[model samples]
Target: MITAPGGRTLDLANLRCVFTLQGWTTSQWGSAVFKIYNLSDDTANAIQAGEFSSIQLIAGYQNNSGILFDGKIRYSSRSLENKTDQVVTIQAVDSHDAKVYATINQTLGKGYDAARVDAALMQTFEPYGVTRGRTAKMPGTKYPRSKAMFGRSTVYQDLLAKQCRFLWQFINGQYVSIFEDASLDDVIVLNGRTGLLGVPTQTIGGGAVIRCLINPTIQWRSLVQVELQSATTGYFIVNSINCQGDTMGDDWYMDLNCTAHNNLVDKPHKDSSKN
Candidate 1:
């Protein structure tokens, strides 16, 4: 018997059920079925219709929420055909959807195909290394000086690579040092920052900058000579920038001012705070 969240009693306790044992039949497929009674009690509505399919249940006490079962159920269907002979089919049950479908599918006309489900079991997830990684967004210095004689741009390839690296951190719980080269393992480029000027200079200066491949994400210093005095030109060390990792939360990219520190350059006496 499963009680709905809105205090509706969808009674299935009286329904006769059957458990299908697989592997005894074949190694590649496993299946089970349950028959629910369609009856209405004087106090509560009987199982007007019950259907479930391909639900995978696991046994564990999940984090004080209650016993936890997490997995995808492949198929499920439920409907009120008639008060007399209601038919239902449920497959591929996961702990997450039990409530929604368990409650309103009869009214919602929803069903999932169990056989068509895709499944992958992994021992671990390392996005940049063996696992796949992804990233998106336009890249470039957000500040306009990024264009005029007062502005500069990070290379598109470098920025995109860094952005991809940043994404890996988001998914894989790791960080690539912006100070390091992207050619190193676990690094990717973001094609983020663009529409800005990144012309190579005959000379290098102290304020040369690099942007994270993921925009508003991170930046690195590329001063040909950090010791250069008052010179404002150089090939921004495109490889030096990496994602500014988030510590307290999941927004390593949102805190741009801290990532690229672009706005800081736009301030007066840009050399005043050269830490």
Candidate 2:
């Protein structure tokens, strides 16, 4: 079910839910790409570039559990391939909406703790509905200048390199929170039963691009165990997760990229206080 602006609800069963999925991770604004059969109604053609002020995408598992992707409707497109064939596709994003575009020019004269820096980042997004969770802190410089920035993605990535910590959004719907902690958590094991779809082709430097079932718990930058082989029997930090699934069908999956923690990743800067 999707709740659009003005409290108008569009029931999936009523609209013929085809297939769609949402993706959220660090440095990137969360997105929900929706494709639904539009023959039953004209909502598709009616929706404008920003028709829906706010929208929420809700899904459920077989057990009757629910997953929510609450964000602003950033874009919409209507298509009619044939006289009788029509479909509506909508793309929604978190508070990090590009529509409200602006460059960040904040200077922390004496930078705060790692957690404080995370809070500052969230502050830029707070007006748009972002929160903090499982924050990590490290001793670091007091001054970091981010001038004439374009978006949040680059700064967050730069912080990851500089602070020796990771920052990202782990979705659980409106309950979604950001991770700024160095010691990550919420480890979910991936295997034959836990939705490990197929063989995870491991790569050099202990990185692997793997696929698995659509599990909401599979957060970005979190830890996971992949029993791909006896030699690869260990934990891997989820570098990224692309969640693609159908709200109406059982065709759901997650394409994940992970890296070993001790993969010799270089830190962008040494703690100013330490030096």
Candidate 3:
């Protein structure tokens, strides 16, 4: 679903979307590209004129569907494909992407602890539509003297995350901080019955790369349970996910790059199990 300016909503028929997610690296801000076909001239013009500000892509069954991508549109272009099909392409970044290059100049008085510093940071980002989400416990470090902060917000966030040994990123307009190996409590079981598409392969970094039917429940930092014959069966943390969907084509799927949650890598399971 794409929301143009003035609160007008649009439901496109011919659509293709790609949404990618990586860990807390500033360079890896969640991004999405949307291609819509045969849009009304007015709508296309609005999008091209920078009036379309946000988009929401949802997937899955009626009762199980959830938001797959919610982001801010950054650019849009209109083109004629084959001289008949009108195609409008929109490029967007995560809501927090603005903060990646946003400069901040602030000072914290002496005795400000990590929690206070985090609160200040959140306050700074509120104007950009960012809100606080789940965050890892920060170190109880307190400043002995006034702390002056300057330069890009991403830089300061990176420094803070490194000091706390946590990974920080914006997910769905909310700031999230979590340990590198930490997994969410809710586990999504994957198997033949649960939309696991093909055999999961091992990446060079000892992680697993999997393809499955579009599952909205799969997101960054999610815990996935793999039950398959050729892959190691255990819990894995979703480090990256690439979601692709086409309303008029056979292209709905998700590619996930996952790391073993506990480094559990026993021999491949010999029996086929249904979960």
What total of clashing residue pairs does each candidate reach?
Answer: 34, 3, 0
How many pairs of residues collide in model 2? Answer: 3
Candidate 2 residue lDDT tens string, 37-73: 6544556545654545556555545663445466666
lDDT of 2 at 235: 61
Worst 10 residues of 2 by lDDT: 266-275
Residue 132 of model 2: what lDDT? 46
lDDT of 1 at 225: 15
CA-lDDT, candidates in order: 0.25, 0.56, 0.72
The worst-scoring run of ten residues by lDDT in candidate 3 lies at 266-275
Q: Give the candidate number with the greatest lDDT.
A: 3
Question: Candidate 2: misplaced stretches above 4 Å?
Answer: 5-8, 18-25, 64-68, 81-85, 98-117, 138-161, 169-183, 228-232, 248-250, 261-275
What pairs collide in candidate 3?
A: none
How do the predictions measure up, each by TM-score?
0.20, 0.70, 0.86
Q: By TM-score, how accurate is candidate 3?
A: 0.86
lDDT of 3 by residue, 1-275 (tens): 77865788777634544344333333256878777888889888977887778887777776688877778888888888777888888887777554665667899899988777667777777778787877777667787998888887777777777776777777777777776556666778899899899888877777888889888888777778888866557767778787777776787788888776446443222211111
